[model samples]
Target chain A: MSAHATTEHAYVPGEIAKPNTAWIWKTFWVLVIITAIEFAIAFALTSPDWRTFRNSIFIVLTILKAFFIVGEFMHLKHEVKSLIWTVLIPTSLLVWLVVALVTEGSFIGETLSHMFSS
Target chain B: MAHSTTLESSSTPIYADAPRTGTWDGGNEPFKASYGKLMMWFFLLSDAFTFGAFLTAYGMIRHKHGVFVGTADKFFFSTAHWPIPEKVFNGFPGLHGMDLPLAFVALMTMILIFSSVTMVLAVEAGHRMDKADVQKWLLWTILFGAMFLSSQAWEWSHFIGGSEKGLLMADGSVMHGANLATNEYGPPLFADLFFFITGFHGTHVFSGVCLLVWCFIATTNGTFEKRGHYEMVEKIGLYWHFVDLVWVFVFTFFYLV
Candidate 1:
């Protein structure tokens, strides 16, 4: 609060603010552990029948990693709520795009198979 | 005459003469961020869309090829099926014949995350206006970024060179390496998507390193110190972290999935 006041009237670059290094380390460990789990899944689950299930796990883990990297690392979690929503609301539309394209692509794949058989 | 001019100008002032209701008014920062930081967030939002489109296209193409309902041994290096990523990215430096899968990429991912940690530390130091601390952390960030780029280069070269046996095409021609034209691993589009997405991400990392260097120099020359804030470091830190964030998705979709 005082930092904001000082910045408004008489800015002080040498203002002794407490650094949040511990939070950085905690975030770092979280990211590392999540990545390790991903690697383990990639190697341990090798059955082709498990492809869909494995991919789902991978996607969930990736989103978790993204949450930490963006929220904590980028400081969005601490930013104003409006700014956070502004950034997130639009990107959420990508989920729709992914589903639409994947469905469309499967249709084309079926067409290719029919033509080849004919 | 002076009083008349003042009244004329004050008649339609751009900002209201009345006191602002709260911080949301034009008189204060509603978002609690500077204009530059807000613009950076918008820019990153746009950039995310570009990457989103690219990755979505990759998913489309991979699905079009159809998934193989067989063992990975049968799927590996099969031209009729989509190549398993672990099989394709199994090479490790200095280990000629080992079939180590996803190991090197795991290392690369750790390197990037470490660099991100350093970058955040730099920003934290900047908050305290500690010049030496900021510089130290920035240097480490830059070095780790370069290391990640170097690892990517090695991976790219390995991809371009293809495997020793190579794939025998339907036309009886053995394709040795991958280009935009054909791939020894799988469909031509597979290589194309790999090239475009990873290459685009590499370009971002390259530019991020350049930006970090600029920030380091500016810190050394007391630019942000003179400006009474190290907000520049924080700005570049955002970009660096975004790059790292994109890699998380790329690593999952491109390599693991």
Candidate 2:
């Protein structure tokens, strides 16, 4: 194949020939703002009953961070829609498994401790 | 005759390098595979599984232990026996003798995350065919990565460099928190597990630093420039971002929980 022809054919349809740098930078700044908020929440909050609120906030922020990292940084957003789903679904499953296992494991530990003391 | 002439005039140009008709879906498919990117995705998938297993095992052990260690009464902050993560990681610049609490680790986390950003920037620069920007961002990423590794090294030293037992005795055997057989913190197993898990993570950071350094040198040497694409930066970005992502879970499970 001729070099020019090869180069021309390399352009995949629906792919942005050039990404918008301004949009990416804007998103990046937004992420930075969220991170600052996270640090603030981590340090400044003093409520005795803040655990639930804090955890929920952290989880939500973290998911948002993950979305930007995957969609923008990883360029997954630019890929085929099917491929994006392929990656996200399995990742969601793995996250669920981690939470479930950690909860069950902690429960067992508590039970064993109680039994030993009794 | 008129229809045929119009059709001939408007026919699309078929390049020699283009895949034969029917080889790919219709005319445009979104999922294009280059060898490197495909491999990166697969590697990331496997790594995800490994992390999931480790975290699951951690959960099991934590549950089985039942009692928290290093509570405020026994150590500092929080009533739970689980060591206060902030207290355990409170090293800070010019704050000697002050228990700053999770300050250093938080800083390290920021540094690593920022490096991930730089890595993506490098990949973006590559997509734009801007060699100088790619080089600049990759250098920044490498510097950030090195700073993180150095910080981790300091953290590890602080962890292991506390007063050594039996130093004056005839046999200078260093005693860790406890042996692997029996002790508080869930039968000494928890300590071993902690060391193994964090140590493994440290090794990954160490190796990642080396890879980043290698990539930096290659970029400086104009390797990516000659290759005509910055996909290599994107490839490393995947690995770098994965490291950062894993640390998120580690922080949640090991520190927050």
Candidate 3:
């Protein structure tokens, strides 16, 4: 760990690692392919009946893309398990918020539609 | 139970036995991460919540107002329902009167992803302590960032400048383009949210570009070399990746889904 005198905090960075350019290219390809698939679905699948299915596919793929970006690009996956958990645990609350919003928003929508109709 | 020991005459503190090797007892780095990196992670975590809240509210509003509930090509704009996003974002620059949907935004997404790749490369070059490679990759990242921002600006202007004829309001007025008060596309709030969310993300991207410029200058001057490490690049790389990550979701929710 080498500390820099210029920085006020004097951060001691961890490890002298080698560069992995191949991994960077691999991640780039994966992101591009995922985005291509998303575009394909958006353009090709145009049936109203497929709206929910299409949305589901997009959501799942977006989450998958998020996983790769966060895990590999951000280097969070290689961090110690404790550090990973610290980040993930707090973010899990977002899932709860999603669920709550869906339920509440639908209820509100139904109520508003009914009220305004009468 | 408190254990008492006689005070030692040595220079070592009396509480030296208080297990510090594998814990946050100040004897070691608990996360095995430097203080700066850890703080950056925490800052990003908080930032994630801010964005999460924005998107969640968007979702709620979308559900509340109700959507057009049709495929991209079959949708029509109306004030009573949420507009189909693809229809609103259909036009590409210099391709007026063409009904290409999601293509331009997809290009924007690719630009951001490419920039992210360059950012990671910069970080990797930093790991190798390769100054030339770091500067090269940072330059590419900054260029891609500018490209993305310019594309976004054109998109916003296209949306705002109105397309097709115009939508008629109940008050005998034609809402030609979008603003906080009204929009030709659909509900007024749709444009409002678009401006607010994308504007906020654009601000982040702009700030990120400034930071990259600073990092580029610092690299050119051999500041990190003198400091014996390139950890600053890694820190900034984390922020750049975060901006990309947010764009990923924005592209999904706003354009695709």
For each candidate, the DockQ is 0.61, 0.32, 0.47
Please provide, for model 1 over A1-118, each residue's C-alpha lDDT reduced to its tens digit, 9 standing for 90 to 100: 1124225335454466567688899999999999989888887988877878999999999999999999999999989999999999999999999999988888988899789675
Identify the CAPRI category of the predicted complex in candidate 1.
medium
RMSD in angstroms, all models? 4.0, 7.4, 4.8
**Best of the two (1, 3) by DockQ:** 1
lDDT at residue B84 of model 2 (Cα atoms): 41
In candidate 3, stretches whose alpha carbon ends up further than 4 angstroms from where it belongs are A1-19, A116-118, B1-9, B12-25, B69-72
User: Any runs in candidate 1 off by more than 4 Å, and if so which?
Assistant: A1-18, B1-25
lDDT of 3 by residue, B94-149 (tens): 88889887779988998999999999999877767778889999999999999999
Better of 2 and 3 by DockQ: 3
Q: Write the per-residue lDDT of candidate 1 for residues B1-257, one digit (tens) a residue.
A: 23332334446544434433333344377787887788899999999999999999999888889666678876656556788888888889999879898888888999999999999999988877888999999999999999999999999999999888899998998887699989898889889999999999999999999999999999999998777778889889999999999999999999999
**Pairs of residues at least 3 apart in sequence or in different chains that clash in candidate 2:** A105-B63, A106-B63, A109-B63, A109-B64, A109-B65, B68-B81, B68-B82, B69-B81, B69-B82
The per-residue C-alpha lDDT of model 1 at residue B48 equals 100
Candidate 3: tens digits of C-alpha lDDT, residues A1-118: 3253234333345433456688889988998899888888987887878988999999999999999999999999999999999999999999899879977888898898899576
Worst 10 residues of 1 chain A by lDDT: A1-10
Candidate 3 clashes between residue pairs 3 or more apart in a chain or in different chains: none
Per-residue CA lDDT of model 2 for B1-257, tens digit only, reads 23332323446765545543342323343456465776787788788788778877876765555344322435432213444455456666566667776778778878877887788877776676666777788888878988887887777666544322312222444333333443222245555666766677777777777887788788788796666555677788888887877776676666554
